[model samples]
Target chain A: MRTSKTTRATKAFEKALATRPTGRCVLRLYVAGATDRSRQALLRVRKLCETELNGEYELEVIDVYQQPILARNGQIIATPTLVREYPRPMRRFIGNLSRTAGLIVGLDLETKGKGAV
Target chain B: MKNNGPQSATPTARLPKCPTGIRGLDEITSGGLPRGRPTLVCGGAGCGKTLFAVEFLVRGAVQFGEPGVFMSFEETDAELKSNVASLGFDLAGLVRRNKIVLDHVHIERSEIQETGEYDLEGLFVRLNHAIDSIGARRVVLDTLEALFAGLPNEAILRAELRRLFRWLKDKGVTAVITAERGREQLTRHGLEEYVSDCVIVLDHRVNDQIATRHLRVVKYRGALHGTNEFPFLIGEEGLSVLPITSLGLNHKVSNARISTGIPRLDAMLGGRGFFRGSSILLTGTPGTGKTSVAAYFAQAAARRGDRVLFFSFEESPNQIIRNMRSIGLRLEPLVQRGCLRFHAARPTLCGLEMHLATMFREIAAFQPAVVIVDPITSLLAAGADFETKGMVTRLIDFLKGGQVTSLFTSLTQSGHALQQSEIAMSSLMDSWLLLQDFDGNGERNRVLYVLKARGMAHSNQVREFLISNRGIDLVDAYIGPSGVLTGASRVAQAAREKAETLTSQQEAARRKRELERKRATLEQQIAGMRSEYKTEEAELRRTDEQVGTRTRVLTAERTELARLRQADAIRAASRTPGKPKPKSKR
Candidate 1:
């Protein structure tokens, strides 16, 4: 009922992969207000998730101002924190999500060579 | 941030302080933590750092009418509330009244990745939301270092921490950040580098198998604070800090006197008793009735309708009360009447400071005019001699400052050894009474001598201290060559001396009667000899007179015969005178 962070993340990823054979990638991006850095991080992360996963992913953008509880629960420290919640392992990129090449490898898209899309 | 709104009603100019409302802490902090500044509290595990930070927030809300927000990175809201529930701080009620906000941030380091340079905007947002929701004037980040432990990237954590302090100050909210102490530095993750306005260190350790909690204000930016390690206590009441150094020697001196319960003992102390509000020390070897004397003093105070707080370290209250009843000192009635309160505790249970804190609290709550500590020597087990001395010195100052007369009993190893500790505190006492056992003629007896009494001409004579059903009595000691005699031996010596006096007196009476009888006999003998001599003189006189009468008769006859003869012989003799030549022969 109250599992640790690693176990819960593993179980959630397994459930998602079993439900969708295409291997869904669930991403959540937490940011402060509509600042330049937050907007830039949101644009890059959404473009990468939507293009590589090709409708096999769910992207949720959260502004810490209107809903700070979720941001804190997600352990979002930086202004623009992008978290890949599914795909067997959760990875975080805290900058403006710049360097799409590294973001792609970090998201496991390189291992599949964008084949899941 | 400086706008004069309801949220920013904290005065800006009044020393820039936030009073924590903990006993003895505000006095040490020179008010409290730096206002609207991030103060760091760091300690080892279970050292009371979190509790200290929580008390800061709770007291701010409850006492100062300022709300608070507690953001926990280690424990959940339920855990924090349950932990503080024992102290009677109704955290749930406070939260319900919107005076406290608890936002427990669940941070798992492995699940989150640090991509690049980032700021803690989400934490800032949540904290801002909590503060604005309840108009919190105080904020606490309990074990913020736990986040660094969870998040591996120390560089980013360190950078954001530096800015977080400034942000809290800019928001005009006094913040307390709890952290774990590093092995070398003040904090494990060096959080002190960021929250540097004020630093408090809490420590818990066991020495001689006795646990003691200590608090030290490591640094206060602009205010002078107590630098010494103060002993603190955590109990159902709350954390109480006890400062070892007395504030100053500014206590008022009282010249009024009170009785010592024993009338003769009072007489020894210049016909009255100890000066009111003065410290009195009772030192003696074991079983010398030191506790008894202290109890009598307490009873005397109770008899005057004044309250007394009796702290017994070696015996339970009921045990002492029962023991006193044997000596005709009924303490239970005094307790029942609410004039006397007894607190019995083992000195080894905690460190000396905790004991001091508890006593300070109890004294304030009871507001006693008199206090008695029976066998203060037991406290030595909790600390070294110097530590115990420091504790007693502070106690003496605190009690004297409150105008409360305090009586203390100490067990010394020997009558004259005067345990250096005993002597150390005796120097500060206004009166010192020494009780000792006088072993003479094979039995031990209690003797009391006033070693010193300030400002009064006290009697220096040692008195035999007696305890019986009638009560305690101090009688002049029967001083002899062996020493001051006491107990059955003293009574036996008195009886022996009394019998010797009677025998000598009877011998003197017998000699006087014999001499009187001899003088009367000699007078009778003289009277008998005088009467015999007088009779002899009478006999001699009568014989001489008879002889004279006979001779006169015979001479007359001869003369008559001679005259007739001389008329015939004087005519015979006178005739013999004619025969005178022949009468010359006649």
Candidate 2:
């Protein structure tokens, strides 16, 4: 039931991904507390920003318990919510963003649409 | 008899309940929204979604003494404060008192671009911050559906919304999330799916140019709730949902009596008036002085030191007060004394359920012993007949349960009395006062009759209702030949009777005078005769005495000669009557 497809939606996504400049990245990472998942989420988001933006990036790591207002403003439901706030269309990923391939696909960093991207 | 959607009353025993404290809302939901679980409130624009959310928080903070956090995504804190100001909720003051926390989450579609990946973690954090700051037990996310518009991420938004509900449940804070109704679904963004505890649909529709608002609980995961589309209103008191519940017949019966304000009407109602806590329906046509009668009742209740709440659908408070003055009912003093309260609104101003809800709210607040709804038929113009009946049934139940006397007036079309028998609530009414306008003899006459009075014997005779400067009066209707007479005819009938009485009285006086004259004549004649008889008797006595003296002198002279004659006469008499000559007789 979930595998139904619309090619227009796919084309739209690829177009949005290709049009992005990706020069200066803005990231807000939300973590719950001083736990393993929090530390892992923070470390992974920081590493991705460093490598991807090449030092031209602003990263905001928010501890949900300490600054819950910011997290709530971001509509954060789960801790370790990485929000890429720059570009034309904002995208969100759950978990710590530890899987680089999954995170890459979610962020549209490397478009894999053959007919479009 | 209309089917009001599907009725699903699944017992939700597992989920703890959160009472919203809004009038009639808790009753419909059985206990309230599922406790600590997110309940989705989806509605069209301007259908009281925001007000309902705000009221939930405010009521939580004020009534339940539970601190709440109102996280609005569309309106700012200032806007919200001003919006709810009419409801008497001081949002800022509540915030200062640490009873509530207001957080505005504005989402703009043009503010962001997609770089890598993002989540609505900020919203969660802010809501958490507000909750923690006040130790809130209730949370409201006002229109989180803005995210569906501000951000082009339906997949992620839907995913995050589910997580939010789960998180709210985990935090043990009851949350209310409002969303706009979708074109084909309850919520535009499918927020109903995420909030499994409850999904309430608020509908605002304009049928025949009359706008009405309705609310329905489409699904409650674990609770029993009314399935009908209840009409809700956002007024000075806030959101009140009118639950169209049946009268369970569990009202506490009272034997006390209260007056109908009109002495004669009271007389018609078994002397003292209606039974205490009884529902009285005063039905009449236009301009039959229904309001005046109701005002009289309010005056009576107020005069008796009982608080009275008068709801005038046809007239404003000032208008009623002024109009009642013509009938000598001065309600302004009672209002000033806080014994009489007036709630006036147009029948078209709100739906039937909304009217019921507003009445319930006012009744709860004023705590009046008597509630008078002048022209309750006006509420029929707002909704279908069945809906109004359901609302009225619930209202009667509520008033009866509280042992509060309630009076409802309805306007019919004509004097036929049976023309607008549309309500058919005579069974529920403890007493029904039917007023009629007798249009005959080139005049309109008002008449009142006790159509029905349950639990008491009431007069079956229709009386001509007389409205004077003093107050309302009911004169016994003349049932002579004509069906019923009133106004000029009644007065003329009374005058005619008075004239006949006067003529009869005059004739009686003349007969008495004639008899007295005859008796005086007879007495004079008798007196004259008595005088004559007395004179004759005196004359006879004098003559007899003179004769006796003459006879005695003659007898002595003739004694010697009579001796010889007397002896012969005695011997002849003895021979003739020998048997009579016995010893004693001799």
Candidate with the greatest DockQ versus the true structure: 1
- Where model 2 places Cα greater than 4 Å from the true spot, the runs are A1-117, B1-14, B61-139, B150-164, B243-247, B261-263, B313-366, B378-384, B439-445, B468-473, B481-586
Candidate 2 lDDT over B400-460, as tens digits, reads 8888999998887873566433446666788888888888889998888888898787899
For model 1, what is the error of residue A23's alpha carbon versus the real structure, in angstroms, after optimal superposition?
8.8
Q: Write the per-residue lDDT of candidate 1 for residues B1-586, one digit (tens) a residue.
A: 5565745544433458899887778889978888889899888998988788889888999999999999998889999899899888889889999999998877766665555556778788889888998999999999897777666667777778877888899999999999897899999878887877899999887877777788899998867789988878786677887763357788999889999998898899999999999999999888989989999999999999989999999999999999999999999999999999999999877778878877887998999999999878887667877778878888988999889999999888764647778778889898999988877567778889899999999998999998887788988778889776788877888899999999999999999999999999999999999999999999999999999999978875777576544465344334333444554566
Among these predictions, the greatest TM-score belongs to: 1
Weakest lDDT window of 10 consecutive positions for candidate 1 chain B = B569-578
Q: Which residue window of length 10 is worst by lDDT in model 2 chain B?
A: B3-12
Tens digits of per-residue lDDT for model 1 on A6-114?
Answer: 8989999999766634567788888888888888887777777667766688889998888877876776666688888886667777777666666777776776546
Task: List candidate 1 segments past 4 Å from native.
Answer: A1-26, A66-75, A84-92, A99-117, B1-14, B244-246, B480-483, B496-586
Q: What's model 1's lDDT at B229?
A: 85
Candidate 2 is scored at a TM of 0.71
